[model samples]
Target chain A: MELRQFCSQSRVVIVAGKGGVGKTTVTAALALAATRAGLSALICEVEGKSGLAAAFGSDALEYDELHLDDRLTARTLAPDDAMVDYLESHGMKRFSHRLAKSGALDVVATAVPGMKDILVLGKIKSLEQLPAADLIVVDAPAAGHAITFLLAAQGLLDAIRVGPIRKQATEVVEMLTDATRCQVMLVTLPEETPVNELIETAFAVEDRAGVALGPVVVNGCMAPLRDQPDSITSLMAAGFSLTTSTQAIEAVAFRSSRHAMQEIQIARLAEQLPLPQIHLPQLLTAAIGRAELNKLADAMAHQIELLQ
Target chain B: MTAFANLATTREIIVCCGTGGVGKTTTAAVLAIEAARRGRRAVVVTIDPAKRLADALGLDALSDEPKLIDQQTWNIFDRDPARSGLAQGTLSALMLDTKSTFDKLVHEHAPDEPAADRILDNRFYRNISGALGGTQEYMAMEKLHELHTSGEFDLIVIDTPPSRHALDFLDAPERLMRLLDNRMFRLLMMPTKTYLKLAGAALQALLRTVSRVVGREVVDDAIAFFQAFEGMEQGFRDRAAKVQELIDDPATAFVLVTTPRRDAVDEATYFAQRLESNGLQVAGLIVNRIHPEFGSESPESLRALAHGNAAILNLADFREIAIRERETLETLTARIPSDAVGYVPLLDEDVHNIATLATVATHLF
Candidate 1:
């Protein structure tokens, strides 16, 4: 139950939530934080987006394990590429090359619903066992697909029953369900829809995959607007014509209420889920570059330290 | 600044495509609401099985069948579209039932009830229908094509799923066709009975050794699923072609939705190019949730009014955010073709109801 120890000890950490809630950014920050704490870490992405490249202020990240910083690395794990790698590592390099050449990798890997996920996770599983990094942080798909993803191994186990696929799925499921080795870290915004999806995803993560749900990182949360002398709404109700200046101030008032609502939602979310929560502030920076990322990384490190 | 009005009005189908968490679904729903308010009967088909769209539309749930918005539901949105003398049209919405849609497609091409049951009963089909890659998007297209041909409404708005596969939605039909048409796949699935009959004992043993990774039973089930399509491949291929043609129609519009973050903006640009490369019509882009800068109020005056108190401090924080967001958005908008971009400012509240969606529609339409 020790927060920092749990974070440090977990071998595979999954970050997921509703899309656009900054899950990728959070993943990068968590990896950066782990590296800061002097732990070898690898952040993984499978969505084929330029999120990490943009975060690192680069052009693109390759499927090859590319270094992000000292003790930190990232890779966009493509299923096709993963299958080829999986085969090659198993001494099927020629067969892998043929599969890639024939355009059959896509067809073969996508044969089942979770076929793609299995390959991606299988590769991650190998990486987890490797000494390349002590922790493997995955920027999984959004809430719905994430559940399907975590359960993919289980699904294959049920369907295939006896084969290499079943054996691979068994390893994946074992690693995923082991609380000491794996954890699901959900990232969400303090909003109705994302919070609702978070609740749904959290339960499914536990009930479906039997994995322990780790800390809930709340992103883009607003700080409280300080108390004022006179209320803007009351002033508006006292019958003054709304000028541009008045309107601007009133808008601020509305935003303050929204911030308060978010605070309440965060509380409600904590009550609803009853898990450890980490809060990330809404940034004032125009763009998140290396500097912003470093700041978030430090804050995350501090949060993990506080988990004790 | 773009011609969203026309795209919202004139197109037979409007696909709001975006990455997850970008308010794409809200935009689609608002577009449908706006079209109806503009006097065009419109229906929005969403892929969020979580019922978020239904909640946004003020309905408890949305099934595959289009449900017309009742008068009571319409009143929840503060504005009166009929009284505005603009739209006065009807609006209905539906949520995709992916499995049922796939089932329907199978049943249609099965050639008979027993044949349909054979494919439908296959373990692979039963387990994989909804979870199959690109199945949701394919079904969304299927529904779009169905609605377009049904003539039930003048407009169909597609809320594309947040597919991590991004461009796969556009080429789903082609991918499916390619897999089905693969000669290797045909050879692999060469029905167990035929395979055993044709292959010599030695050849059969080699085949079994090669296929054991996925299980012999899985191979059998896969062969059953594929062979069940013996006479139906052509029909499915033709249907896939027709779906492509429908998307290629000049009247179709693909609206790329995104946020103004550097990552989101870059992804949007990439998606816009992908749609064009696929030969689909790119109507425009909606950069949603842009923070609007407050106009012309000298910050000095506001600070002087507040006498260095908390109100100005809070307002100043938001003002700074507004200015920063505006800069970031301008940088992104410049990369996009000017005529292909529209803007929606950040709303203080999440777009969770018909009323809120109406507010969004104002900026959109």
Candidate 2:
């Protein structure tokens, strides 16, 4: 499977996971990968996370898109701004501004359950319809809220009998369930809790939200140490200066066990989720910069190539 | 004693807050266990936890009420060398059941049984009680207040939701109060007939737009729900004020937890700043899963020793990670006192059982 083919398969790829699982990073990496594959990519985050913009060596993102590369762009979308945009695009321009000024958007957002999610999803739906970019990747909210976030459309359809809101939700649901239009890619660490939550979230999105899922991105995996001595004891028995220190032996022991634990979780994830896994190596850096982002993007491209 | 240990033992309330996947829940559990080891009756209220962590705390199917960790589980904690000679104390764990907590609050604040039942059975209430943006945070605070007033635990440790909205709870009570006080909310509280008759043109236009947007039916349901609680606003208001006061109480301390990752560190600093703006300060900082400094060997010396062996090269990678982590730790802890910062080394495995949690506590203390 070529990375370009994967990018073309879905107009929108929603990256979701538990917090700190690198969903934003993966979202950026996927966009970068798609752009490198010669596709125009737009990455959007809902939570106004500076990390997303910072990934591309930019400042904080506002509602307007910030051009990151020749084929890449990024922006943050808030529900209120999306709502205003939705209204103005729908020909209620003056009314929308007035509503925003009066702080009625907050009221309207809170007036109905799931209205906030619908507003954002509705904006994304319009974006998808436009074909302004070959790919649109959304950095969704964390897992717990993400279930409710993705399912808001269906939930709203059930709650509201008729109105523009219901119509908007119905459209959002259409975009979500259509496999070619949108697919959610959940990110997770190769750990127990996140893996469990990812499995649960994957099913809930598919079953309840009626959304399609793409390959799971397993972030922070430790690559296997190659050309190794058989064991820590054996390595220490070699009696090098570094090996003589107990901390070195301990470090090796720690890495081995951590690797073993990660392998176990990865196996468990494979057994349960049934999604192709794209393993991203753990970078030993204080922060993810442009260099690390390219490294992760290349890793993703390599994995996508390996996928059948 | 370390300031963290002292804070864990002495604080009446410790709220552990951080971004997700930073081990906020586990850190909360560990602090609770430590408090219990020091002979304080500590209870940890967690919003959601991993299955293994729930099982480890003997709360697999925990209800809204606090469930005490059995003596047998304490025996596991007692086995740790760090626990030797420590006075054994009681530990209880509670999982936050948001909807039920809201139900209890409605029952408590409602004017009468019929009113309570009316609000509880509202279609809108059923949806928003659990799914409202900050309902879980508000309910967590409500539950904490309930537990505090109960006098059942000497210390209460609460694990907040992920950082993006972790501080939402701080404003949740006020937000709730403002929501109740909003003019639209009051207008909606009116009977439909009265609302239409009295609403100004601006108000009418807004409602019309709202109806066109959300559907007339949801507005009706929302109105009915608010009408059901017409007389109970005072009660809810008073309760919200009390919760706010309790949160602002000097005895309630906040703990900022994070990993050494850039984003998590940024979130921690942001959380700390938010707390400071609220006239509160982080009592302690716990940095989890840090790669420890391996050895004194320099990369050049290690390379000479490695002589192209991949495993030896891997050891060099570990040293780089350790150094990067130490630098990151310094950047983070530079904002706070050294004694107030607890950096736990990367454990050999994920903490699934009590034994592993005990291991984390050893590093934390």
Candidate 3:
């Protein structure tokens, strides 16, 4: 499953992983890829992570939707704002005033169990169902809770057997269950804990929700240094050989171990999951921006082609 | 002494707080082992659901009280079988079950049986206790207070839940209590119930609608739960306030834990800033999984020598790992407050069992 092929085919694509595993970066890269493909794409965020905004090189964007380019748009859904929008859409504005005045809104809103999730899902559903956009990519919350958020609509449907709530829940569930139109990708690092969590997340998504699992992107893999140990050791033993500097010896040794560790982790992950695997090299640069995202997009495009 | 070494002797409480999957539990265990080795009677408690401490300590199970480990138990606590031979000074551990702790709080505060039963039996309460983000943090404090007041342990270490919003634990009680104390809910319900008493048929229709939406059984259970907790919300509020005071006390110390990764550091920084803003005493920071800085050599020389030779390459890989590890260390040191950074190197094997923990402890201290 190449990134473009998957993006072109699916309406709802969720990027999820342990926090700090570059889910936002991957989401931005995919959105950029979609835009390059001439498809109008929207990158939606539920947790208000500014990573997306930072990736897009814009600080002025707020919770509302803003166009990143002619074909790409990005937006963040604040739970409170989403709640207000949801209430207003349901014609509860009159009740809102009364509720706010009497402190009923405080109680209802504070304990508004599942309201954040409901609104987030509602927003994603709205964006996906919109005729203007070809794809909607959600930079979802961290792994553990993202599952809960995705499953909330279905859970609510089960709890609420009748009325408008059930109808809304049904619509959300249908969108999530339509595998041809929806796909969930697990983003992970080549480390023990995150990899383990990613595997668990995959099982949970498949078992609970009937969503299709796409390629797993193992980010930040380090390739081992190619060199001979005896010569390096001999050089180190000889202490200042003209052929090698101490810093060079250190750098090679350091890179080699990281590369080996990463390889082991990647191998472990590949064996555990049946899904196609994409490996992203560890970049030396600290600040990743649109240019870096474009580079990643190119790589994803090639991977997508191979998958096809 | 290094900044972290000073922490070992000076700090009373070292709370290992971080985002999830950053090895907070293992780090906490290692710290406790180190403190104990330094002759402090250390006790580590974990509030995470993962229960990693047992695996780290090589223990089959951890009770509500501290369990001792290590072959040199003679150095601190007694290893003898006699009743009085058990040494008072040594390392120990306990795991906190947040839900059970919450249940205990309810039992302690509820005014009557009905109120207690309502809170305990309420579906909402059950869900909140089990799933709420901050409850574990609150419960952790409650347990810490219990251990602190017990006077048995010399040093107490706490491992918080791996929350992206690390400060949520500190803020949970207030958020939960505020929701419970929403004055508008009471006023709205008061008039609505009276109006329903007059318009019985209309009230019945509303009830039917609610029952259908939330499930008749769940609604009934909730009503029963609320009815039991009648007039007891204030008690819970007061207890929560007391707990908050204890958490804010100066004697308690918070230790932020993180890996070298950008995301982990961001979270640690956020936690540090929040804790500092709240006037909480943040003792120090622990950067785990640091790569060691090997002796300097250029990448070209090392690569040229490492390539085409398996042994050379493996050694080169070790050195490269060490170099990256150094970069991570430097990054962490620069980002974290200068006075409060401790470094722990990445080990080859999992730190599972007391012996491995002791090895880790040596490095941390």
Q: Pick the candidate with the highest TM-score.
A: 2
lDDT string for model 3 (A32-69, tens) is 77877777788887777445676667774567778887
Which residue window of length 10 is worst by lDDT in model 2 chain B?
A: B49-58
**Model 1 lDDT on a 0 to 1 scale:** 0.76
Residue A87, candidate 3: C-alpha displacement in angstroms: 1.2
Q: How many clashes in each structure? A: 4, 0, 32
B1-365: candidate 3 lDDT, tens digit per residue: 55554565566767778876567887787667656655678889986544567766656677766666663632321222231233334778888877777888788878767667767877667766755556667777777766777788778888876665557767877866765654533332344567466646743554454444344655555445445555777877776777677677665667787776555676777787788777775677777766555555544566676545444444455555556556655766665564666667766644545555555555555
lDDT of 1 at A77: 88
Model 3 spans with C-alpha error above 4 angstroms: A1-3, A96-113, A226-244, B1-12, B20-22, B50-55, B58-96, B131-133, B150-152, B188-227, B260-263, B289-338, B345-360
Please report the candidate that would top lDDT against the real structure: 2
Enumerate residue pairs that collide in model 2: none
lDDT of 2 by residue, B1-365 (tens): 77778888888999998988888888888888889889899998988633434855655576679988885675455555756668578888888899999999999988789989999988778876866677889999999999999999999999898757889998899877766676766876787788777776878887777788777876677778778978888988888889989899988989888998878888888888888888887888999988867776665667778767666666677777777777777888886543477878778777767788888887767
Every candidate's TM-score, chain A alone: 0.89, 0.94, 0.88
Report each candidate's C-alpha RMSD, comma-separated, in the order given.
4.3, 2.5, 5.8
| Chain B TM-scores across candidates | 0.87, 0.93, 0.80
lDDT string, candidate 1, B14-58, tens digits:
888888878888988877876786678999999876678888877
lDDT of 1 by residue, A1-308 (tens): 33345557778899988788888889988898877667878888877664677778766777888887898888888777887787787666657676677655545554455777898988888888884587889999777888888999888877776767778889998889888878999999999888988998999999978989888999887766566536556444544325633655665666677788798789889889999888887876566888878877877777777774
Off by over 4 Å in 1: A1-6, A225-255, B1-5, B75-88, B164-166, B188-210, B295-320, B338-341
Better of 1 and 3 by DockQ: 1
